[model samples]
Target: MMAFANFLFIVFLLPSLEALSNVNPSEYQQELNTQALILQACSNVENLSSCLSNFQGELQKSGPPTAQSIIHAALRATLDEASRAIDTITKFNSLSISYREQVAIEDCKELLDFSVSELAWSLMEMNRIRAGIKNVHYEGNLKAWLSAALSNPDTCLEGFEGTDRHLENFISGSIKQVTQLIGNVLGLYTQLHSLPFKPTRHDHNATTTKSSSDKFPEWMTEGDQGLLKGSSLGMHVDAIVALDGSGHYRTITEAINEAPSYSTRRYIIYVKTGVYRENIDMKRKKSYIMLVGDGIGKTVVTGNRNFMQGWTTFRTATVAVSGKGFIARDMTFRNTAGPLNHQAVALRVDSDQSAFYRCSMEGYQDTLYAHSLRQFYRECEIHGTIDYIFGNGAAVFQECKIYTRVPLPLQKVTITAQGRKSPHQSTGFSIQNSYIFASQPTYLGRPWKQYSRTVFMNTYMSALVQPRGWLEWYGNFALGTLWYGEYRNRGPGALLSGRVKWPGYHIIKDARTAKFFTVAQFIDGMSWLPSTGIKFTVGLGN
Candidate 1:
């Protein structure tokens, strides 16, 4: 009996102990590889030790780090950092602070909430990718989420400006640590994509064909088609709004506020030709709201909100759309907030899967804010000075007109500021088959973030474009990570030799690569854009 008991202990308990003590070879190798990758990527980041320490416990618990596992680890660290910010800000909010400081603290809390949500979303996307459920929109969605995660903190810090320097510094330090962790995660995600091995296709059911408008999906109903072409005003929709009190509502907001929340159907609001001097905010609950007006200049929505008024830049949009599936056509949204005021946004679109057709967004500074998600601008005119067309959304401007407002003295002009904060994000400004005309010396874009991306393809540029096609953001060495590219752009401003010799700048030779920036592929416009019935050239040549 004693011998048998000893045998059992040796075979069962001893082996179990051994298993716990020793790492499996495969697991060991995976961990080593992951560490190597992290070290390789974070070599330049001075906070490497702190970054690793933040994620170490999570990474160890995760076991055998695959690309997804590393990404998960990074996200966990970022989320933890965001939580600290939340706690810090919450404590700050409870203090005896000045009115401006209180406001800034409140803003910080909201932004920290956003950061947490975005980090959570980044984790979710990684899980989805791991589970073989590939979303065509996943890349852009993930990037926009992480970028928002990073940008919100910066914005929060900006709010604290002139409020309290010590508080601002404290908040900045906390947020900056989190931002670095996120940035490292972004770099890791990008590394996964750049790996030589082809990623195993887990989503066998997903269609992998190149975007061709010929394969329109079931969502493109005939009624939808009619609305796209300006033929149908969607009269069957909930209401008609007119400035002259000819319809159910006189103001656009009145109609929007009364509409069914999250209604799947199009809530059409037809605005007759007249200048309406009001700020219109299509709230999130008012999904699928469609606004149409008598062609551009005739039917206008205008405002005069500027940064000089102490309003947050995000709050200064003339026509702000946070609703999903929002559509605007044949109208002009203008911020008469001149160049002197700085950072005045004409139209700020935070809507997901939103679209603008034949619309004009006119302002002197910070004109159009493509704030987030997938957005498409077709046959539209965007006029601005400075970083006029800005934000972190995966946006496509097809066959549109990009106009540059005259700049104030010593105020250099840039057309787009693609604020992609993460390398993993597919968000960028893809100006395809568009026309760029400016009165003053202009640049195609400036890097607004570390990994800013802007591409111009088959577009026409006037001679007013500066010889140095793209400029840096002050002295920022963003050229190394910024993705500024041009392809088949014609006219005097299309001089490739005179363009910046930045490491991230590209002169595209492959049509296929250029095609990636097209409306069909870039924004996944082919799937749902056709439903709007707006005629769009979905390809480079079209």
Candidate 2:
């Protein structure tokens, strides 16, 4: 019996001893080689050289620590080395090319891809070491200590098991950090690459450019060409319509139907200040269209189309955009259907690369349907009661105001319902530099399905945002894979002290880990988008 007790004690004590064992020399050597390869992949001369130096120093400093400690130290060193490499990449500049001209800057992009892949593989190996520790027997409450260390989502290693919350959180955080580093690296790459080797001199004899060009400001123009000027493009609208009181078009549909669809020139149907009571749909071939209104608050497009009306929640849209490259600025899309009538969408955007600027979208349920493809919304207002912003698309909401109208009596709900379907689709909503307000108490978001992913970054939230910011939509078992996180958020809603036990939502404490959702990573704004005069934020710090 005494021998058995000693055996048990030995078994228990082995894990702690193992924890102190020297890190595998082979693994350490492999990490060094991989780090060098990753740095070379970044292709930044200065960054690569600096990282190489740092990596050598770290390896030399690694001494007689246990295998677990050495592994931890190695992971930390790898992360630091990766960060330095990313910093170097961020300083790179992009090469400039004439409009419609193809540039050969794929080298940097390819290098970045390889680096990211290598980093991902390295992280996986680190996770394996972490997982192995769990199986190690420890002495004198070593399990408790191990549990505590692993409890910290950052250091805990993870495996492929679906129930491993620690691993999930760690990967989420790591991905976010790596993404940001990639962004910075890309930003620097663009800047450096775009620099002209030879500077051009100005000619004083050239004709002076007009002080007030007819072109619309570049900020207002879509990605196509120069902005449309009222003088050059003729009157923006052939006619003006107001629905509140005096106007030619009484209902919103009338104005839309009467508007010329096949104009050779770009035509904008400017709606004057008023709330139009009608559901609007833009059919196919409604090309080169632009909808401009007085303001989001003053110009409202609203309707009540619910599921009971034989309409799928997707079809019952107050305003549906089917035409490609459709643009709506300073307007409001609203569905009057209360929560009692579920699945009423205010706006369904089926068009590709559609953009909404300074607009407002409001509804009780399924308010904004970012249905398909990539969509961008900036400085807009979105309000809804339940699953308000739900869809499967690569949609980005930047510097927008999100409000949750008080849920009516008998209604218990959450706010955002991101319905991302797959990991490869690149379809999800990124809410950055935004504000979340709840008219009634609400949860920040809930998984609409398995693999549903949404990110909120540098946003402000009200107390109405529940401490458990995310809730499960029904009891979907697949939600274990859903990705949700909050970083550097302020207000009562930001408190993560008593968050739910689910492994999806992460309170990212490190700024390095919050980069995945930044402007650079989400849209590669650093390269092509900055020319638009839109300020693209870099890194995870606000």
| TM-score of every candidate relative to the true structure | 0.80, 0.54
lDDT of 2: 0.56
Error of 2 at 51 (Å): 49
Residues 327-377 of candidate 2 have per-residue lDDT tens digits of 787788988888778778999875544667778998887889776545677
lDDT of each: 0.75, 0.56
Return the lDDT, model 2, position 453.
72
- The residue-level lDDT of candidate 1 at 43 comes to 39
lDDT for 133 (candidate 2): 41
- Measured with C-alpha atoms, the lDDT of residue 67 in candidate 1 is 70
Give me the displacement of residue 350 in model 2, in angstroms.
1.8
TM-score of 2: 0.54
Runs of candidate 2 exceeding 4 Å displacement: 1-239, 243-266, 509-513, 524-541
Candidate 1, superposed: residue stretches over 4 Å from native: 1-24, 31-84, 90-107, 120-140, 161-166, 192-224, 262-266, 283-286, 526-533
